[model samples]
Target: MDEFEKIQKLIRLKKYETPGEQFVDEFVTAFRERQRAEMLKQPALSLLWESFRAWYDQLFSPRWTLAAAVVVIGFICGFAFMPRGGQTHLARRGKAPDHPAMTLSLGKDQTGKTLPAFSIETIRVMGEIEIEPDPGLLSKHFTGGYDQIVIVPHDEADTAIAVPYDFIHLDGKPDIR
Candidate 1:
């Protein structure tokens, strides 16, 4: 017989082959039994991990995603807004700090020229300062909201010229460039 004819005969014979009726009926029962056996042998940690993984997968599932996200967000907001010990966050922030913001103690050096003394204590929230443009519908004398940058002289304040990020020389002539 030629290759094509031999292949056709083999396929025709294969069509008759099928699993017995008993296998189909017992498949679900057999699968459940195997799963139960596997679970029984699994360690506590493994079982906990599997449960957590399954729960995490379910939380992000399409049908439950919106509800789960809302619940998570609500919990976060609740914790953030809730007072700790005896003080609310806004209440604490509003209260005036115990220490002075800035203090300058003057002392004359050996040369008797007043030694430039400056102590500045500052806490800054790192963020981009947003300056919204003024439309100037009802314009004042000054174009901007603020009048000008007032620079106190060296004698009035311990002023010195330094680099852009002025860590050393705090009080100095303003860089207008």
Candidate 2:
């Protein structure tokens, strides 16, 4: 016998049962029907839903959201502790009462003449000043025109004795000096 005839005879003898063609056709039909039904259904608010999900995801992430919160807290704390322009605790406590009105006259060294204007204000002395008379100007004027002014608290009256020049000296250190 030929190879093809022999193979066909062996197949017939085995009597193997194959799946019904109707089963495959039914499965394909059902799959197509389900796909058509889903395609026909309307999606409500799909665009809005997608946008909301994207925004929600970004806001919940640690990097951007946590940094924004920290910056807001820093600004609040900065404003709370910042000092106002004219209100200072150190000036209020250590300011000279009488000499609150103090002035320093700045003038030309070569000429004995005083300048037209000068500054007068409260002195807040924190340290000592060494006064050496300007020899060049002393011949023309008895007192040195420009002298360093030292400001100290009013209660440190005894400490004021260290300064030499009369024109630039405080009258007396306050008890609270």
Candidate 3:
């Protein structure tokens, strides 16, 4: 077609798709309304994910990028220098404890098959070992002559002296009884 005819055809197509006076405003309003409705109707997990995405996007924004970086670096350095639980008390001071204080004995069931257990060992707490404490409660659990057991008063063991409770990942059947 000639240039004029081509222009006419293009204009005819554009006429049907012309931007309405409130096109931007209407679109924005509908978008915001849909977002609000979706947020209201979304399940908890979806809301959490959306919130996380928003926070993550905010973290990358110019206003928050530097603050987020500083916070991240601070966390990294803090964790890097922190004392880990596996490091023995003596080992932290450049000396390894003699005869590993605590050792794990993989337990076997009465059928002599490996099963689950918290830990079976001489749990070394800060005190002397008592071989069969209190003759009255001595033969309480086992019958084959009580082996040595360590007992610590609650007041002593419950102290807040930097115990690595969270780091105790050694899996064994918890001594529930």
Please tell me which predicted candidate would have the highest TM-score against the true structure: 1
lDDT of 2 by residue, 34-119 (tens): 98786566365765686789997876887777888899999899767754322233444555443334344444445766543333
Q: Which digits, one per residue and each the tens of the lDDT, describe model 3 over residues 116-172?
A: 323232222232221112223323322223233322223543444532121121244
Comparing 2 and 3 on TM-score, the stronger one:
3
C-alpha TM-score for every candidate: 0.39, 0.25, 0.29
Answer with 1 or 3, whichever has the higher lDDT.
Answer: 3
Instruction: In candidate 1, list every pair of residues with a backbone clash.
Output: none
Worst 10 residues of 2 by lDDT: 123-132
Q: Is candidate 1 or candidate 2 better by lDDT?
A: 2
The local lDDT score (0 to 100) that residue 91 gets in candidate 3 is 34
Comparison by TM-score, 1 against 2, better one = 1
Once fitted onto the true fold, the runs of candidate 2 whose alpha carbons sit more than 4 angstroms away are: 1-56, 86-113, 118-177
Native-to-model Cα distance after best TM-score fit, residue 16 in candidate 1, in Å:
2.1
lDDT of 1 by residue, 1-177 (tens): 999999999889987787877887799799999999999999999999999999988767866878888899999998787533233334445454444433333445558776544533221212221111122310221122222212222343424432122211124323222
